[model samples]
Target: MATAVLVLATVTTGLMAGLYLAFSVAVMPALARVDDTTFVRVMQRINDAIQNPLFGLVFVGALIAGGAAVWWHLDRGDVRWWVLAGAAGYAVTVVSTVAANIPLNNRLDRAGPVDRLADARAVRRDFERPWVRWHTLRTLVCVLAFGCLCVALSVA
Candidate 1:
């Protein structure tokens, strides 16, 4: 049961890591090449689109499963420590997302459509760089969590 939960945690974390990796490596960079209007418009659309239930499930599930795995493995010394580490890493990812990225996303979303904005460049300036930095942090921590969970699985 513990192993199954740990596997679930690892898979969800890996999925999230892949998402962040995709944005970091491909999506953001591609957006960077476009004009401010296009960038902001596409990003706003994406932000709105990503609020769906499926993404929320994996995002929150990763944390919940990681915590459950830790509880389940508490009696197993090696597995407990690894699950703790993984859970801690994922916790940071979640915190950072809420603390840093979501606010920026919210601000951008509130800025209304790019076409209606007077200065799309200003909006993009406020959002893009900081959002990317936070997202990069999320990507790293999530990947670390996934790796730690994978190690826990092997040791178990």
Candidate 2:
């Protein structure tokens, strides 16, 4: 049961990390550059649209399953700190996505096309950098949590 829980947590957190990895690590900086072509703009729109619904699943699924996974081990003699760390990691992933990503998405929606969008620089200045910072932090935390989960798996 513990093994299964850890597996679920591992898979879900890994899935959950996908968007953050793409954005901060991959897309945004690329988007920030370039001449903001139609293809580039459309890609941003598609990427933005796709991520929200996915995150909606990841945030809820990771938490409920992760919590249950941790609970499955808590009173058992096989308990490990990695399990605790993993459970906490999923919890942080939920908080960071909810608190950071969703709002940024909404702002992007409001900002509209990079070409016509007024105060694009303001959005770029005020929102983008901070969002990246928070996402990087979230990614680091999730990675640590996933690492701990891996350790738990090794012991169990």
Candidate 3:
């Protein structure tokens, strides 16, 4: 069960990190180039697709599994801060995605073209940069967390 947790957490960490790199870091600049209608459509697609409730379930599962693994290892005196780091990483991810992006998405959904596209771009610039920053922190935390897992594995 604990091992399962670790694997799931790793999966969660990897998935979010990949998304951060692909969308916020890579695709967003190009996405900014589209005309208003297409831009809104694409952004809307992204907003709709990104944060499914089921996706949250997957993330929660990963945390639970990984934490359980850490707990199991720590019970035997092979302990570390990585578990906490993983939790914190995911927490940052969830909070930032929910707080910043979701509202922007809602705004875009309700807004019209031209003006809305410009507004979306502004919001994207302000919010996306910070999102990337938090994502970097998340990746770091995941690295630390996985390192702790490796340490646990080694001691066994």
Please name the candidate that would achieve the greatest TM-score relative to the true structure: 1
Please give the TM-score that candidate 1 achieves against the real structure: 0.98
Tens-digit per-residue lDDT, 9-65, candidate 1: 989988998999999999999999999999999999998999999999999999999
lDDT per residue, candidate 2, 35-123, as tens digits? 43443355457547776766668767878877887887786554556788887986887788789866876776676677876565565
Order of the predicted models by lDDT, top scorer first: 1, 2, 3
Scored by Cα lDDT, where does model 3 land? 0.60
lDDT of each: 0.93, 0.72, 0.60
**Which model scores highest in lDDT?**
1
lDDT tens digits, residues 1-156, model 3?
656566666666666566565665567778667754566677767766866887777666656666666565555543435555555556665666567656666766666553545565564555455645655665555555555555544554
Clashes of 1: 0
lDDT of 1 at 63: 92
Clashing pairs in 3: 5-65, 5-66
